[model samples]
Every structure is written in C-alpha cells, then in structure tokens.
Target: MHPLFADRPAAGRALAGQLAVYAGRDDVVVLALPRGGVPVAFEVARRLGAGLDVFPVRKLGAPGHAELAMGALAGGGTLVRNDQVIYSLGIGEETIAEVVAAERRELARREDAYRLGRDALDVTGRVVLLIDDGMATGATMYAAVDAVRQRGPAQVVVAVPVASEQACRQMRFVADGVLCLRTPSTFFSVGQYYADFSQTTDDEVRELLRRAVTAG
Candidate 1:
C-alpha cells in the first residue's frame, strides 16, 4: 500500500502538520476540490480552525475519452485548456464548445447543491488555501487557481498530500506558496499513493458541505 493512504485521516493529519503556521488564522480559508479533497481538507481545517468549503471544477473531456481532459472549467468562469491535447486528439471546435457548456452546467449544479442557502465566502483581501487530494496533470488545478484569482484574494496557497514534481512546479507559478507533502521523482497516477481510493459519492460531498456550512 502507498504511504499516502496508510489511512485517509492519517494522511490529512500529516498534511496538517506541515501547515501548522496557518493555524487559528481567521484570514486563511481552505477551499477544497470535491469530492476526494474534502476529507483531507476536513482534517486540516479542523486542526487549523479554518473555514472549509468546496470549489467545484468540471473537466472538458475529449470526445469518447471522458478521462482525457482537454480543458477544465471551474465555478466562477475560470477556464483552462491544453490546446495541444485538443489538437492531438483531433477534437473539433464544436465538440470542445459542447463539452465546455455541459461542464459549466454541471459545475453550477454542484455549487448550488453544496452551497444551498449559504453565500460564497468572500475571498477578497484574504489568504486562500486551495486543497486537493493530489494532482497528476494539474489542468484542473490550473483552472481552479484562475477561478480563485478572479475573486481578488490577497494570496493563494495550494496544498496537496502528493503530486508529481512537474505538477508541483507548475502550480507554484500559479500560487503564492505550495505545500506539497510528497513529490516523488518517479511518479505515476495519484491512486498509486493511496490505499483506499474509493470514489467519493455526491451524497457524501453534499453531507460534508452541509457540515462545513453549519460549522462555519
């Protein structure tokens, strides 16, 4: 079993330790990418006494290859795409438009479901800590950073349990500080580092968000 997933909460607790400086800072907010990132962020948020919430992003998958994201769209109109991937895949403009449109709808739905009557936390002039379980290509995270930047945060910090060295480097340019727990020289998929990487369900995401909203 990979060390990152010896236990899910343990992994998060370990990550929290590395982020101790941010503890008890009211100006620091932790925004986690759902669904896998929520559990990890929960531990960090609890330890730091920081507010936790979800930031939804949807991949603009290539035609017939849902796992291959040519681009991604995050809630708040942030869009990031790898044109090379689209060109290599021969994805047409119409197809790309369709995928982005569909993804936007899904992103909005998730935001509505997770946030409900609660208002989005104002990021302006505050330090934002973006958390994810792990990153592979980082396309999703790039879009997320762009989305958060649109809100005019005072600073953006990206924290993750594990990621490829390349992904970590790329993310550093987009964030003020990057807190990556592990950056293996020979990296594979993010799942390779996790023991119980079971898919997180929508119901679980909703419940977690509900709890976060109530607690904050």
Candidate 2:
C-alpha cells in the first residue's frame, strides 16, 4: 500500500480535513506534543482558526527498553505511570526517581527552547485539542490529558495522523473525544505511514511555533 502522507505537513492537512467540524471556532486551542507534533498542530490550528501552543511531554522509557514508555511527565508537573509495566518489570522507586529527574531536565530544556519565554495559552472553559504525530503506547497523550484536565478545559480531544489500533482505543477512554485518521492493525511504527518521515529538528519546531504565533 502507498504511504498515507508525504510528510508531517501533509499528515496535518489530512487530520485538519477530518476536523472540519471545528472550523472557525474561537474557543478551540490546539496543543501539540513537540517537537514533531508542532508541524501537525500548526496546520490544524490554522485550518480550524484556533490558537496553537506546545504541550511539552517527556516519556519515561523502561530501563533497558528505551523504546518502551513506562510513563511520561508533562510540563505542568503531572506524572503518569503504567503500573502494570512497572510491576511486571519490578522497577523500583529509586529507578523511577532517577528517570524522572533525567526526564524533568530534558522536559524543561525543551519547554524553554520551544516557548522562548512565551506563556501557555489558557484553555479554561475551552476545547483543548491535544495533537501528536503518532501514538505508540499513548503514554505521552495520557500525561498531557491528565495535566490539561487539571486546568479545567471544557473538553479534551486527542488527535493523531496515525496510530496503533490499541493506542487509539485506549485514548477514547480518557479523552472527551479521539480522532485518528488511520489506525492500522499491523502498525510497525509511525514512520511507516509517511514517505518522508524526517526527524523534526529543534530549529524547525522553534520556527513553526514562531510562525504559529505570527499566524495567530
């Protein structure tokens, strides 16, 4: 089968198409999980006439299983752990604390680099659209939703270009709504659906956020 997207921008546009119901809304805010999600959310916010912001979240990978997310930390100080994974692997508090400390530093660094002194947009009493390029385990989105929920958003929606079938289903339980353009049962990785899945650089993320601010 052909790839679903040429790149992140294409994926974003496709996602925006499905979200046409939200067009011209003043109370909508799109918060992207950077640095990849910025490009995706930029197009969604632009197309929907919504505000754009980055919701920095850092995944805590299981020790020795770097690709497996055991939990995540949100910018708003919310921590989400997969207790099943933690207990199954016998991960202790000392290990968890060490990982949290390391991820906290990285999360702060990314927030500073992406925001550049800008304050987060207020989502109180408004619809919050949490976007990401893709979801593997849904750990990051769970943490983001948990953090954002505390701030009193009227609604929280999780959107992605493509995701594993299981991940999309899990999100539906937490998010007020969930929209995924593609959910392949045989999903290997997010990059598989994009023809040009290049790594999104920090410079690109910063530039996109700058443009989003200007666009707003």
Candidate 3:
C-alpha cells in the first residue's frame, strides 16, 4: 500500500465518517462522477443511505496541451472555462467548438452507459452531494456543479479525498460545503497522493453502480 493511501478502503471510510451527519436524509442524494468517482461515492452513498446517481462531465482539452483542460462541459450544455487558460493557450473559437463538440458526444455516451434506463434523481430542493476521486484544476468538478445547480438543488456539497488548497478555495465559491480530507499546499497531480492510483475501467464503474442499486 502506498503510504499516502495506506489502506485504500479507509479513505472512503474516512469520507463516510465526515459525512455521517447527512445520513438517512430523504432530501439528500449522492451524485458520483463516473469511472473513478463511482467507487468512492459508492462507499459514501451506502454509508449515508442516500440515493446514488452519476453526474457526467467532460474536459475540453487544449489542442496541444491535451492534459491541460481549457474548459469543461456538463449536461444540458453547461460549459465552464478558464478564460485565462484559453487566451494564454491561444485556443481559438473554432478549436474550442470542435473540442466541446467531441466532448459532448463522449459525455452523452458515458451518461447513457452509466444511467442505463434509470431516471435521473430530481435535484429540486434536495441536498446534492457531488463526489469525485480527487480534484486537480477543479474545472471538471465545477462544471458538474454548474450543471447540477441548473436543476435547483437546495445545496451543493463537494466531497473528495484530496485536493489542492487553491482548488478547494475556488470550489468554496461554488459549493455550499467543501469536504476535503487532505489539502496540501505543495500539491501535485491527484494521482501522486494515491498509492494505488490505477486506472478505473468502465466495467468497474458499471459494477459499482449495479451493486449500489442492488444494495439499496
């Protein structure tokens, strides 16, 4: 086990402990970002006895700096971008359009695969907890929050294992509450803080959701 994530399951367990106050509330729902977030959110939803669902968001990568996200897109065409990054990268309107178009398709495909025939949970006047594996630039998670906010959730809480201090501060402006276990000032990529930062497969995500629904 990596020292940072000595016991992998314990990370989720810790998040559950922090979120215990919200347990057994009918007005609360857990929305996990697919792929990596599913497993972490599974533990949280189970512990909270809250309805679990997926909230998909896709990153619009800069043309040359694919890892560097210029912006993000979420359901219902909620787009959030860092104008400084876009301008600095010299990302033109045409490039942004193309990237967003491609990401929208991918987002739709992921949503279809994850949600299947299950109806999306109504966020109207409900406390919506958004979960992801971790936070980097926070652009993607911000996009998710922006998309969910459109449905008029009573509150928005973002829970994650680790995040940059700056990212956490930025998220505070958007989320009602930000629950982060570790916010290191000398932050690097989120994966660096995880001992077992293996790639999460689509099948794994599907199985996690299936199990959550079955357990419910």
| Residue-level lDDT tens digits of model 2 in 65-177 | 88888899997789999898899999999999999999999999998898899998999999999999999889989999999999999999999999999999999999999
Error of 2 at 114 (Å): 1.0
Pull out the clashing pairs in model 1.
none
Supply candidate 3's per-residue lDDT for 207. Answer: 82
The predicted structure with the larger lDDT, 1 or 2, is 2
TM-score of each: 0.94, 0.96, 0.95
Cα lDDT tens digits, model 1, 60-165, are 7778877667988998688898898899988888888888888888888888787777888888899998988888778888899899999999999999998989
User: Clash number for every model?
Assistant: 0, 0, 0
Model 3 C-alpha lDDT per residue in residues 23-56, reported as the tens digit of each score: 9999999998877787788889999999888898
Count of clashing pairs, candidate 1: 0
lDDT of 2 at 172: 93
TM-score (C-alpha, index-matched) for candidate 1: 0.94
Ranking by lDDT: 2, 3, 1
RMSD of each: 1.6, 1.2, 1.6
